[model samples]
Structure formats: structure tokens, C-alpha cells
Target chain A: MSETTREQIRDVIGAHANLPVDIRELGDAADLFAAGMTSFASVNVMLGLEDTFDVEFPDTMLKRSVFASVDAILEALEALGVALV
Target chain B: MGSEVRAVSAEQVALRDRLIDAGHLIPSGVDGVYGHSAAFEDLREALGTRISAEARTRGATRLTFPPVLPVRQLEATGYLANMPHLAGTVFSFDGDDAAAAVQGTRASAHEDWSEFQAPTGVALMPAACYPVYPALARRGPLPAAGAFIDAGGAWVFRHEPSTDPARRQIFHQHELVRAGTPETVLQWRAQWAQLGLDLLTGLGLEARLDRANDPFFGRRGRLLAANQRAQELKLELLVPIAGPEPTACASFNHHLDHFSSTFAITGAGDDPVHTACLGFGHERIVLALLARHGLDPDRWPAEVQDRLGAPR
Candidate 1:
């Protein structure tokens, strides 16, 4: 994935994930839930990602693993055919 | 959780019919609605008494509530957002006599009369502990030791209708909620879980604790349930009722600042308090007793009768 797409994912997470820690400081593979993100807040993050990417996540992608980390979110978007560049 | 559909097994159907035939449960002709016979009520009350006695020993503040909960309280808890499919909202006809006549005519004709009914200020209580949050929030900040509320046996409603007698639409849940530091709440929940297991086993039923999750709604809810399980937020005491799958007769849930944040329930220095609740399904417990023992409480095992304080 392109750096631009990664930045976008980070931006959405920062806005919607409700994580107490700074998004920039967290690594790509950092666990969001461990960083004080709650299950209710994760829904907001998913909705934000959907809005930013202009794609709807199917029921199959609606899993904790898909939203576990920034890398996982990027992979999900790519699988949904979201072009990075 | 509402998406998956499981067919009702013949064994469940037979057990339900058997209960009805034995006059333990008076059928209301609805799938999950049934009137309890005196024996059933007495057994349920005995179980409730046993639970209440334990709660009293723990210095719990006993509170009784009606079957309906204020709609605003339900909304504040964000229950509907997660489990909309299972929530049962109240509605009433708000109209003049002429409009009432029309509504009555539609009802008599067996047509959809719900259009005449407007949403009420309240909804059927989804859980026993729901009313406790808003009530405690009204009391300002909690004391240093925190709050232990014994929400008495109140009728709670869930919209799921099934032939399985264990899965009732309306049932009495004896729930106890504790709001304090995470340690206090977690310890209280664990204590209750053990007590519940002991009580069930003492009553001659095979019961065990298992990690569990609520039946949250929709795609987002799937992730919520998974996260709940991962964090060990909920646990259920399951017992075999009819079929092979054991039914959850009671549950212990740890709400890490979910309710405290929602209801502004704070401890000393306005710190967000963690909360947890353990609820026992009185009807389901009694049903499990019946399934394990026999229909006649008088003929129950001496040890089981002694445990329940059943008249010999």
C-alpha cells in the first residue's frame, strides 16, 4: 500500500478510534484495544474508515481481527479493492 | 448474534409440552409467554429467597422496580444501539374516544392496530440492572466503599420468542450490581459467580461457568462480541435444560466504565467507577431444577429440598 493510504488510515483512526494515545506514536502493528479503545469506539472507527474509503465493509470483514491494528485495517481496505495510489 | 438461527429440537418441544401437561407452566398460547403455576412460582420464589439472603449478607442495598423502565434511561445506557433486536419498547394509544373506537375495530378485525399506538415514555425493562445505573447517578458521587445494589426479582423482557422454555420473553431476574474500583467490581463479580455455581450444584443441578457475550446486533456487533469475549467481560453459568446445548441460567458481566461513563457515575475525586453485575434467571433456574429433579417438589431429593428449604 502507498504511504498516502496509510496516512489516510491513520487519520481516520485518530479521529474515530478514541484511543487515548497519540496515533502517530503507535506502531503500525500496535493493538488499538490495548491502547484504551473500546468496542463501542471501534464502531466509530469502522464507520470513519468506511466514509473515508467510500466503501462498505461486508459482514465477513466485520471482525475483531480486521480492526486489531492499523496494518490490519490497511489490509482490509486493500482486500476491499481500495486503491492506495 | 441475532443473525444465527437454530432450529428448535424435538427434545425441547417435548420438555415444554411436558411442563405444560404437568401444569407447571400455564400456556398463554404464545411461544415464550406462559403463566406460572403455584408450584413453579413457589420454587422460583425459594430460589430468589436464597439469592436475596446471600445478597443481604454482603450488605447490598435492596431495591424493587416495576417492569417498565424510562425510555431515556434505556437510551442513556446505549443498550438499544447494540441490541436493538432484543429490546421491547412500550407503545400506547394516545387519541380521543373516536380514535380509540377505530383502533378497537382494527384490533377486533385481527388487523394491524399498532399504527394507532404511539411510542410511550417507557420501554419494557431489558435487564434488571438497567434501572440501577440511572438511579445511582441521581445520588451524585459514590461513597469510598462504592455502591452495592441488589436489584430485586423484576420482570425483564427481551424480544426473542422461542419454543425453548428456557428462553422466555418475560422473566424474573434477580440481579445485583456493584460500582466501584475495577478491583472491587471484579472481585464482587467473581464472588457471586462462585456462589451461584455452588448454589446450583447444591440444588442437585450440574452447572458450570463459561466465557460468554451478549447478543449484540448487526455487523459492528460481531466485533463487539468478539472483543467482549477477548477481554473476558462476560461469563455465564450454563446448565443443561432440554437439548444438548446448555442454557445460560445466570450471567456475570464486568462493565469497565461503560455504565459509569454513560450515567456519569463517579467515585471519589470524580474518577470514573468501574461496574459489574451478576444476574440469575429465576425461571430458568427453577426449570433446570425441574429438569434435573422431577415435577413434584414434595418428592425432590432430601438434600435438594433441604438446600431450597422446600417444605418436607
Candidate 2:
């Protein structure tokens, strides 16, 4: 479930980031914003993540760095107590 | 009727071209600034008169602030933390004649003479409501029901430079600000948001109320944006002023405890006051009127002219 969740979130992030490079080519720790995730596009990515997880991000988890990289994203999810499969 | 209302492809682009051609707006030598014609000013004053009448009906007190805002008061709001990109602080040369001469030479040579100028300890007021919080703070406590202030159509500044005529550097906001309990302020703003759409639509302009977000800063701002939308903290009354997308002409913001906590406004039971503001962009409204109705106010639909009152 954890692997699936991570992969699912990552896929949504890549699709919405609108980056020039393929999200699959980047390392898990690579910065998504550095590659081009605009503040506008990030909203779409956020909504996508919420749909995939069946959870709405609480206010405490709403911060830029959480969406900064794949690793950072997983850390945020872990804080939500999602088990890492 | 909705489909009959022609949604122009590029309203801003079209507005700028047509407004200038019609002598409704005059170009100033600065980006984002324009000189308004008498007709345009009249539109603002007329709108102000109508809004003022509504405010009086509600017993709302009216106040107008100068264009400049105290830098300290502005900083206290912590507005810069999220939207530093949008504000413009006032600054000046505070040096001696010799320093002035040096600055003069630099300025003449097109060098960065402005570097020598000191901070004016103030900034151009970015929104009509910026001064309201501190003004309320000066008074010890709020009334049990709290208070509402009508800030009528004053000049506010933003750093956005745009060729879109509706997007001016300096614009006017006829704002109604309320400070009260969470229920009082929020409900009032929500009411006005819907009323605003009805008013515009009644005038034959295709208007709608939609959930909206402030142009918050950076990646961190994305979270702010999402949170704002999730809570439905903002409301915008959009009209197809320019482009395929509707443009927001008026905005309603629910500050919850943001402004009260900043300015220390306390209500009954000594709780932090909640704030909400409803602001209408005077110039944008005028442009919308011109775009939808004819530029000649005399030729406007009888109903719109009746709502706006007689033109000068």
C-alpha cells in the first residue's frame, strides 16, 4: 500500500508539474520545483494527491517544502502515519 | 441570456485598445498607471455615491485613508511575508546637499541614484483596508456587535505592471470592512458577495460569484492557495472584462483572525475580532461597463443607468 501510494502520488505530481523533463528520469530526492512546478500548477497536483489518497491535507501539512521533492513528499505522508510498504 | 452575452476572447487586450481610442483612459508615462478622463472619474464618483447610499442604509461609518500607508503598520500585518512581490514601499533621499549632488550626477547618468535614498518609513497603501485595522486598534475595545467602516473609493497601489487596461498600477477600491465575531463578519461578506453579482447582472452585465485565491507568494504560497480554496476563504465576482476567462472585478476576503490578531482588535468577551472586507475595483467596473454596454453612458441600458444613477 505504501509503495502504491508513493508511486501514485509521484505520478500525479509529474503529470501536473508541467516540467520540461520527464519526472520518471529524476531521482526520488530531486527537487520538483527546481524543474518547473509553478504555484498555479501545484494546486492541481495537490488536488490530485488528495483524490488518490482519499484524504484532504490538513492545515498543518500545507507547506511548500512538503511538495519540494519526492522524498520530502513521502516524509510528509509519513507524518500522516501512512505505513511505508 | 448567458449564452447571448458575448464572451470576448481577450477583454483586457480589447479594453486597452478600445478605451484609449475612445478617450476614456489616457496613458501616463509609467507602466501600470493611466490618467482617467472626466467621464471615467464621473463613473467612479457615481459608483461611490451609490455604494455610499447603501452603506448609510446599513449605518456603516465611512472613512478614507491617504494613498501612503505607514510602513510599520503595514509590516505589522505581516502581509509582506506572503506577498512581498505585490507591495511598493515609499523611499526618499535623506542625504546632505553634497550627497544630493552626487545622487544627482548618478541620476543624470542613468545610474542607480535611487540606491542613496533612504526608506520613507512608509509604503503606498496596497489595499483600502490596510489602515482600518490600526485605526480600530487606537480605540480600546470593540462594541458588542463590533463595527463596520465604509472606505469609499480610494487609490491603492500594486506592483503588477500590465498592458491590460483593467489591471492598473494604481486603482480605486470602494471597500466595506467589518470587524466583529466570526459569524458577523463572515456572514456579512458572504451576503455582499452574492449581492454584488445580483447588482451587476441586474445592470445587464454577465456576472458570477466564484471561489478564488489571492496571488500568494512562492511555493509556500501554493499551500496557502490550496488552504484558502479548501476553506472557501475568498470570493470573487467575475465578469468577462477581457479574454476567454472571466476577470475578477470585486473581491470578498474573510480574514478570520488575521487582521484582528495583528492590530489587537478585541470584541465582546475580549476575544480577538474576526474581519472581512468587500472591495469593488472602480476602474475595472467602469471598464466592464464600457465593454458590455456602449462607452457612452447616455446610450447604456436604461436599467443600468438607473442603477448607476444619472451620468454627468
* Candidate closest to the true structure, highest TM-score: 1
Give the alpha carbon lDDT tens digit for every residue of B192-264 in model 1.
Answer: 9999999999898899999998988877788788878878999999999898899999999999999998888
Docking class of 2: incorrect
- What is residue B297's positional error in candidate 2, in angstroms? 1.4
- Flag regions of model 1 displaced more than 4 Å: A1-3, A54-60, B269-271
Q: Local error of candidate 2 at B120, Å?
A: 1.0
lDDT of 1 at B117: 88
lDDT of 2 by residue, B1-312 (tens): 101112334556667878888888888867569988888888778888887788778878988789999999888876686678789998898888899999999889989887678898989998998899889878878988899899899899988777888778899988889999888887788778877887778767798888998877654465877657766888899987767777788999998777887788888775657999999998888888888888888788787888888574
> What does the lDDT come to for candidate 1?
0.89
In angstroms, the error of model 2 at B267 is 0.8
* Most accurate candidate by lDDT: 1
DockQ of 2: 0.15
Candidate 1 is scored at a TM of 0.95
Model 1: residue B26 alpha-carbon error in angstroms: 0.7
Error (Å) of candidate 1 at residue B184 is 1.0
